[model samples]
Target: MFPLEHIAIRQAAYYHPEKVVHNDYYLDHFKSRGKDIARFLQVMGREQRYIAAEGENALTMGYQAARKVLSDAGLASEDLDMIVFSSQTPEYTYPTNALLLHHRLRGKSRTITLDSNANCAGMVAAVEQASRYMQSNPHVRYALVVGSDLSSVNCNPEDEITLPNFGDAAAAVILERRAERPGFIDSLYYTDSDDCENIMFPACGLSNIYNPEMTPEQIRISWKPFDGTCVVEPAAADIEEVMRRNGLTLDDIAAFCLSQFSLKNIELICEKLGADMDKFIYVGDEFGYTGTSSPFIALQRGIEQGSIKRGDYIFFWSVGAGWQLPTVLFQY
Candidate 1:
């Protein structure tokens, strides 16, 4: 592990499509298709979401956002020492998204390419990893952090279960070392592998085990209606423990950037902590359930939209597939 002295988040960017899907359509279909679908969505507090129009994969979306980060940081592709792409949804199972991004970057071979599949806790985890990498490799000057997800493809549109809420988006952040002061303060990570079954894609990747008699189409149908309860209690308790470990109270946190799973869960976490709800950043209203892009998207949007101020102590909390809980503390 590298010891991080100082690191700053240079800039962040994201790509969200403008296409809109109406809630009424889902409501009507769910009434006849699966009532639990409608109820689940309603409680999730997602009215609509953005989806890639066409020919938009995670790699492309990530490229679009990563280019913005490069431009914003005023650094050329040659400056990056490492590219850490965080996403469970890769363009292909063979070549990782990091390699695809490297291609888009026009052959930056000097950079060590890697990918993280931590879903919700990805950004925080990436930040931690990048910081450690920079700390160890003193010669490495910069690292590119990408959190992208195109969840709409897995969304069961006709099933009316999780269609309206699933959206696709990508966010990229540049990490660089600083002399006087840096951005990230302290990060806390926790994982409960036992609760991995609480949330998942149901059918995709290795989970889609081949049945001896079932056809691919039948397997696909079995994977549809990917609906599961996004339990936050265990995650909430973990976050609280992290905060306590840092010897900081909820009031010490200027802003809360949480994994945007649902509106109800957001409220539940805030209420349990008795924290100010207004301090929490909300991206679900526009971006929807972006599996891994939630934190970075919120950070970029929160800063751009004036939701966060300079020198604000931002608290990031994320929970994902492994039921992993990772909390991060930063100042910007």
Candidate 2:
């Protein structure tokens, strides 16, 4: 078991772009291509989504989320010992978004900063590493874990399956080390590299190098290929294993905060696990799929909605582009 001690989420916050788009906005565009907008929304289970404005990107949204979390926690920028950020849509190919965010926050020189690119599963992966750092280092007291993505930019407007399912958002949480508390419990992570292409942007990375000669418009348009079925079985096995190793059952979990893939997928998983569907918090219908920020946003919403409470058991899980699955159970 990968149990953690003395590490707890002190505060959590999230930020969505100011611009919002409803599914109806895409109706005419899709209908011209012989695609039904109503059927698409019925399958994906999302009605509206937020899109980043012209100037807004991962860094700006992430900074806003981090600043809000720090303010809510009554902490200063200098008090942070580390900052861990996760994103697939960064502002630049170099200098790393984490380092840039550290500068934006005016974090102390001693603050360790780095980035993890796990796509939708990014936040849980960051939490695992941040919790380990806080547990091993007595000097480290507080750390900021962030997950943000501007997925709408990479979506192909003509692609019926992926175009309408994405949204832009950022979320941050402050984790503090305590003397004694029921905090993080075991976590399980799995990756199936064989299916990596199921959800990926093929043109922007090293394999397909960017062409300097191409026009600005040509360089800006790229599509992310996504297949939702790739992770279903693997995620189920991972969740079952985590529960078995922790000696807990589905009945023991007070809430389930999972990636906002779809309402259908969530229902299927709940049925497969024999867990109560009411225990899962879903924000995708209103916020759309916020990439890596999905689960954390749901966590904060659960607390605000009174579905999740202190001393409750939370089972958090996410599956990202690389077919990466990470599941964790903890007590608040």
State, as a TM-score between 0 and 1, how close model 1 is to the true structure: 0.88
lDDT of 1 by residue, 7-116 (tens): 77777888777676656666777777646566667677777778887888888889999999899889999988889898877777667788889888974678888888
Model 2 quality (TM-score): 0.92
Judged by whole-model lDDT over C-alpha atoms, candidate 1 comes out at 0.75
The 0-to-1 C-alpha lDDT of every candidate, in the order given, reads 0.75, 0.82
Q: Give the best candidate by TM-score.
A: 2
Task: Name the regions of candidate 2 deviating beyond 4 angstroms.
Answer: 1-5, 202-227
User: Which candidate wins on lDDT?
Assistant: 2
Model 2, poorest ten-residue lDDT window? 214-223
Query: What is every candidate's alpha-carbon RMSD to the true fold?
Result: 3.3, 3.0
Worst 10 residues of 1 by lDDT: 219-228
- What tens-digit string does per-residue lDDT give for candidate 2 at 156-275? 667776678888999998888876676778788887787665555534544444666654333333545555766667777778898898888887888899999788788878877878
Q: Which parts of model 1 are misplaced by more than 4 Å?
A: 1-4, 32-38, 158-161, 198-231
